[model samples]
Target chain A: MAALNIKKGSSSHSAYDLRDFHSQAERSHTLALIVDNEAGVLARVIGLFSGRGYNIDSLTVAETDHKGHRSRITIVTRGTEAVIEQIKAQLGRIVPVHEVHDLTVESAAVERELALFKVVGGGDKRVEALRLADIFRANVVDSTLESFVFEITGTSEKIDAFAELMRPLGLADVARTGVAALSRGA
Target chain B: MSRTMTGAKMVVQALKDQGVEVVFGYPGGAVLPIYDEIFQQNDIRHVLVRHEQAAVHMAEGYARSTGKPGVVLVTSGPGATNAVTGMVDALMDSIPIVVFTGQVPTFMIGTDGFQEADTVGITRPCTKHNWLAKDTDRLAGIIHEAFHVATSGRPGPVLIDIPKDVQFATGTYTEPRQARVDHYKPRLKGDIEAITRLVELMESAERPIFYTGGGVINSGPGASQLLRELVDATGFPITSTLMGLGAYPASGKSWLGMLGMHGLYEANLAMHGCDLMIAIGARFDDRITGRVSDFSPDSTKAQIDIDASSINKIVHVDLPILGDVGHVLEDLLMIWKSRGRKTNRAALAGWWKQIDAWKEVKCLSYAPSETVIKPQYALERLEALTKGRDRYVTTEVGQHQMWAAQFLGFEAPNRWMTSGGLGTMGYGFPASIGVQIAHPESLVINIAGEASFLMNMQEIGTAMQFRAPVKQFILNNERLGMVRQWQDLLHGGRYSQSWSESLPDFVKLAEAFGAKGIQCSDPAQLDDAIMEMIEYDGPVIFDCLVEKHENCFPMIPSGKPHNEMLLAADAEAFKSGAALV
Candidate 1:
């Protein structure tokens, strides 16, 4: 039935694509990079994105191989598929970057982020905050007479839900370490 | 196996080891030590310029003309800052140049010391790569690496900032052979499966066109030769970008001239009407692909480039072969021949018939003026006079540059140099000087507009000192013709700040600089004036006054597609926006 709709044309190129090229949906992608642990390498990577008008939702970097002087940077960015591909290619062109792997498509990756939420309240709001924190498996890292600081580690979505629950319960301040991701299996 | 020497001496030594014969630079306070080393050395020659910017431009001209990496040395602060424009210009055009800056003492780097600037930080985005040598022991190794990075894979400018203290300190001198450059090896040869697939596509491409660019020249003369051979073997039409003009001879049977915004009528029409588009060593820059979504909508595209990032960056291609242009063409040619060199000859003949009909438009034609020289007429005369000589041409950016690209016929690679990517004004005069310096006997010319000629007219002094017999052929249109043309067409003729008023008598200025100058406005006297300029043994500036309102035609308006080009006949109608109706 699908073959009946096929139309012959002068051009040999086909419009059928695995991913629709015409669709302009913005998507989130997590990319892992291995780069030389040298001075100004981070600046070069960040500058490329900023210079080219690409957006970074979250970014985290640390030296993974101390002996070899190699650092791993995990970046979560949002763009259309074509823009994402360009971002990855541009990242790979940086001199110190050795590898850029899009973990979003390469594997069923595990993503985690650590965040701290400080809730300041004096009455029912304080109790409600504690109850929600206990349900989400968040530990009270610091406490006072009227305030409590909860530390939570989870996927970005889970943490977002937890933060939403705390917002109505007198969420005062929040700090998040950007996402870090790794592949699931060998 | 290594000898210890001051870092300044190592800087000079590393340049020699890298086979750099000339250094275009200006001496400064922070660079006195290195200048002293340059003074002590006889193996290398340094050409001093009046300003730091001209030095870099001169080096770019030398590099582009000779196929060797140009070298530059300057001081920190203002010196490094002045060089930023040329560095970015070279970066945009993929010209291989190594710029070295002398910095303040290490301890005073960030303390607002005299003549201090964060050279690495300011040039990070513009340069291919850069380094600030903090250790004297690593200076030579880093210098060698800078040269390697500048010339390798998709050649571009690179910089290294050497502190004054580091230059004074002693270090182990490392030979270029001893430098560790193992990490940065770009892929040179294409994958066999992809090459075979491309050959299959080539065999069946009825309306195929080869769109080549500057990468062919950067890959060396052999790549250009291979390109010509491939074009001949396949019997396909070829067109080039502005930077790739000389890669294929304009006189070739299959040549369609240059294609882009200001391209020939038939070449652009062929691009729009082609079934297969084979891009060799060319990026699909927005200037080449106006309205990208509608650009060659039906073509099966294939791109061959050294930089992997350039593939699928703009227009996605069906086949992306990541390799050097030379190697890929060599493989493509061999496999194509092994398969009996098949082609869709019947369909190609039809395509040629269409192209020939379009060529009948004669888009480059203009009415020859008797009073004032038309810019096009001037360039055509210049071309007729210097067609077959050992001539090198550079141009300042404007309508005159496009006219030169249209009228000048380049027979071989490396004979044409212009600021294609950056569209820089004031590039041609010093560039012509550098080319003259390198090839002392070649007939070098800087095609200029009157407005752009004044931007770097100071280079005449440099030419006087060096005795470089470069010719400056200025089309004195008395206006910024391109800006005024755009204003007339797109902005309702409110020509603001486009007039070249209060301009100097260029002939008097040239004579004042101890060089010969000739001024001519009559169409009949153009050939004689050009002859006088060419025959002079010293630098000559020919200010040829031209028609003020003349515009370059066959233009695809900024947002329009290739098929909607405005030819010379449609210029007036299009300007009135009647063509849209």
Candidate 2:
């Protein structure tokens, strides 16, 4: 019975420093992991992070690229040096997980997280939020209450750009899953 | 993995593994399948609350009563929306709760189907994490992840919206997988350099003080016992905020009394004069710090907590130890152990001498007249009676609430349940009902002021329906005590109709609800009233008509500290000696 492939150690060293993780909003990283499709696997992964007081900025899971027998997970988190290593090691321990890597950790990787941003504005600002949404290739899901909910998917940086544009235009709230990624080409 | 299981079955099994005993919920269209499977099961006890909101609050009460996370379940649209208030309440207080709401079929998700609303979308801002499960295979994992998110990282509420189609779908699911969080880590390890420095400072400071908060207990009980050690060693006087009520047993030496709006004057003064303030797990909330700029300005503050954001968020810290309180205290204790240390009581002797004099003067002044009953006297008896006996006591929101919290010297964590952060007015009855349900074997009491008693007086019938042996003690002053007290203190007693209209016989109301009721007036009648409640098989009420114009003293008068209290309940210097002009 190959229950766990990733093993925590007698001296399990974590990836990042515990302090100043959340405080670094700009430097904070969100990584989405892609893994083999299996049950109870996600729980094992989340339990590892939460059992300790590690925070997840955003998380989303879905079955993408079914031909490869895989699923995509977008996770937003913050940490430093030793903390990042611990996260990868723990994910690899799950039975159904084939690999675990932070899409934002290395230069070769590309990361993307989806956000449905809701903004409330009137007059000129409403026109501005709409024009910016068009430029970002976002779809409007709902409107009224002097607001619009725009559904957009791209790299977290792109989403941030869109949100930043909407900020002056009346960005009320944003709901996003940190990031999800897959290697380019076969 | 098993082939015979459906997704809903696997979820039920997973909740059992997570050690969930009580589940508060209401059933609706989308969640019928889960309820069907639940009906056939025997392990988890399901409570049917009157509304979806009540289910969430009941879960919150259960969580507060027990030190574990509480679970609430509801169905699509309105049912899920009904939980919004409870969810926000839990979020504000940093309580651990997992809310499960049923959703419409996956095929009908976006086509405006029956009872369909984006449960996950609605809850995104308020929850720590949320899930929209279309695939049944991930059901167990989602539940597990929801629990992990809610209980971990500053503790909060999480929501999982399960579509009906997914629940009925077949899937081979095992247990939830535990994943590691690479970032947003908790500081279990303290800075050795900072900790030792504070310990050395504690050893020498002439007027050092120890102030603690709810964070101490959150760090765990073993950590709290260290308070006795530090105080015994340094002889520093101990004071606390409203939320830090039970960090220590009330009747101990070196205890300066509570500090804040309703705190003892000496404790507030001592806080100001102390050269060093050792604060663990407490934020300098405006209620505690008063006019922040003036609060203990001369003292060097040492702040410790698990949340890093809280480090410099409140009062500026000279020494900020960002880590779990339990871990930090244990490390300090280890360092203290190697020093061959013994408690030094010299620093406390003079302070205790001053406090003792203050206590005597207070007792002489506030002594109840032959005719009127003192509200504090009732609480004093309550404190004496419940000693060592484990009980759950909740209070309606008002002056009596503060009085109970101030006087109790609570011996355990979670023993006192009231809306501390939210301060909900009508939370008492329902909260008491929830507590009683959680601890069926333990006696539950709801201490209510005259006005706070009316917030959910309707629940007396609910208590009767369960034949729940819960007691309600009404401190009847015929007015909203706290509001009137504020008006008296700050508004020149303009008394803006905060007082109640002519009273109803609460005894009759209790009788109407099929429960026993008693009226109490004398201190001697206290034991008999409480005993009569113990004898009753169901809900009971104790009405003690107290003095109409009484005030809670040893007052810290809003922004003052340590020695600046009104000094006693009836300090003559605070009064104008001449008769009304």
Candidate 3:
């Protein structure tokens, strides 16, 4: 009930209001969802977003509580403040969704992505790649004379930077697990 | 111990337990078992429709008229796909309808077997909720759940796709009370603190308006009664969305007519200028709030809706009470009365004076001709003749629909049914039949345009077969009147495909279906012709020829704000390059 208190002239106004309408720019937010792990539940969630034309930049879902029959879905989507609020409101209306928490809005939340970089080269390029991997804390999960597959785990931004640095040197292939997010709390 | 029965028998048993008296449906390959069960049972009457689409529309009409979840049964594939439009229409309007669609046998599904369809997949987005029963044991439970989902909180259409094998296989019949559907619970009561804030706002505002929608009707008859009581107690000027008509008695002193795109001039002006706007059960759709940024700019708005997503979906409100309309209105009345029923009468009087000035514009005025009957004049005559009878009016989409909304005055909820949300073209004919079936002795009329009526004209056969006695009052303008009007205004009058050329002789068409047909063109004979259509004991089709070029005015053109309305008097000015802004 306390959260229901109306904020006087809150910065987040309805999209219909002309005063602060254009002031808010669109930004990406990651949301963690706990829902019933049942048939068509995932489809219903996906249908809601797709049917409404809302963009989903990244999405990862897995069964989190097998005993409780609950699955966790992490979705990264971009929208204006008003649009994001509407998305959350709509998601909450879906019957199977037990909880929806925006990790982006949470004070202490961690967002990490695992990526495998297959760098294929020899001599100077291989040595340089190995030295860069050492600095980035990327372990060589798979190694061959011609190719070295580096297993890296970090924030998406860090992984993007590492990939960008490895591109010119010897980056052959890239596989990434889209952002898996959770809040930092007991 | 639960009794064992085939799934087909369970479907019928479940429907009987749900208190369904009649079902509108069509037969197909996958549904033969259910149809056979229906044939054996005397408890539920099944009305076979000519097409699957009309069956859904009829169910919608039945639902709207009786305030019950209308039941529909159609087969797999094309039958299910054909029902998509009507389901979407019901979804948009919040009409409670439970559609049972037959699917291919469990093993044949996804193999593209005969009459196979992904009905659940296709309709997932259109329905409020849907289920695909893969097992026979779940069929009875799913049907019960479908009824629950369709009739609860914010009522809407729900579908249960039962495969042929499931229908044929034996299952334990689960009674309605035994069904365990604990996941989908919608909130029915309003927040007490929010109600307090709303009462505070209502008492303090100078120019207050109650802007209600179809939610008031969908909530129940008691909700409409409470709305009337609230309006009477506060002495506030009230307006409504197109779908919200009949929720408040039109003859009531506080009524300001329907407000929106084609709403009255005074109503739109009042909406734009009001200080306090109370939106009950009405979503702020694009049509209602034209140019959202400029919508109700000065109002401190409060919205009472059963659906949480509807609050702040289009226009943000100062107070958002998420609850059923009846529940919220009951609390509102109690709180207001406890507060000594306080209202600022002086300010309300001043507000009424301003509204009277706007009313002087006579936004609905049209040139009445003695030769060809004006569409508005025809509706006025129809309204005059059918005023006091037990009448239910359904309408097709077009200029005729707007004219009916303007000319007809509804005194009660559920008496006026139309395609408001999706604006389905051919909804009225089958809907009229459905209403007639629900209320056999009542005078049911489908006020239709020449073009929209043709969309589902084949339903004339269904009416004839059932002896529905539903009247089809067509305003034969020989054009898609609304589209033609838009072309005249916005598209430089190119007149593309709006004309209804090569149309059949409706009189002959009526006779071919074994129904009476009356065509009235002369203005002098209009009233008598309408009376003849009314007086006829059997189904009648009255094709009343009207002025083709007449436009539905007092229109807020798409994307324009409510205040920037185009009045009928200003038609010439707009055509002659006057400043529309």
What's the candidate order when arranged by decreasing DockQ? 3, 1, 2
Please name the candidate that would achieve the greatest DockQ relative to the true structure: 3
Predicted complexes: DockQ each: 0.28, 0.04, 0.34
Query: Which ten-residue region of model 3 chain B has the weakest summed lDDT?
Result: B572-581
**Candidate 2: misplaced stretches above 4 Å?**
A1-186, B2-4, B104-125, B172-174, B177-185, B342-367, B461-467, B502-504, B521-526, B554-581
For model 3, what TM-score does chain A reach?
A: 0.86
**Candidate 2, residue B168: lDDT:** 95
What TM-score quantifies how close candidate 2 is to the native fold?
A: 0.72
What TM-scores does chain A show, candidate by candidate in order?
Answer: 0.87, 0.66, 0.86
Clashes of each: 0, 36, 0
TM-score of each: 0.96, 0.72, 0.96
| Candidates arranged by TM-score, highest first | 1, 3, 2
In angstroms, the error of model 3 at B246 is 0.6
